[model samples]
Target: MAETIDDKIKNYRTAPFDARFPNVNQTRNCYQNYLDFHRCNKALAAKDQDVSPCEWYHRVYKSLCPISWVQKWDEQIENGSFAGKI
Candidate 1:
């Protein structure tokens, strides 16, 4: 079965590396991810921009440094593959 939001959140929380910056330690990465996530959420929601949390999340996660998964995530989001899974 597909994973739920709770599952994703739990994974993110307990993940070995931070979602924001995957190369960094868990604590730092988690904090960074949280900040970026909130920032993206606010920007998208408040600014009425096409940018979604998924976009930022994906970019940061897949970046060469820290979190490179973000890019992979962006692809997923763009393709409607990561919907509700994040």
Candidate 2:
């Protein structure tokens, strides 16, 4: 049997150190999670599939990113000004 998204979520762990975010700061990790969450949601929704897998990214970004940054990005996305790929 295949692992379900819920299973993955239940087994979620902190992300390991990534080359892209080698410094002490986790800014890149936060931003990447933000982008990943949106992309995951969009792709899953387009396929009419379960989106539970995307929750991992949401949790990461929510924990690592400032609320203001998230709010600003959301506004940018709404206004078509966000620079990152969705």
Which candidate number would show the highest lDDT if scored against the true structure?
Answer: 2
Candidate 1 structure quality by residue, lDDT tens digits, 24-79: 34545544554466467767777777654354454443342344455555577679
- Deviation (Å) of 40 in candidate 1: 0.8
Task: Report the lDDT tens digits of candidate 2 across residue range 1-86.
Answer: 79986876677676655687889999989999999999999999999999988998898788789999999999999999999999
Instruction: Report the error of model 2 at residue 29, Å.
Output: 0.6
Q: Which model scores highest in TM-score?
A: 2
Off by over 4 Å in 1: 1-24, 51-86
Model 2: lDDT to the true structure: 0.90
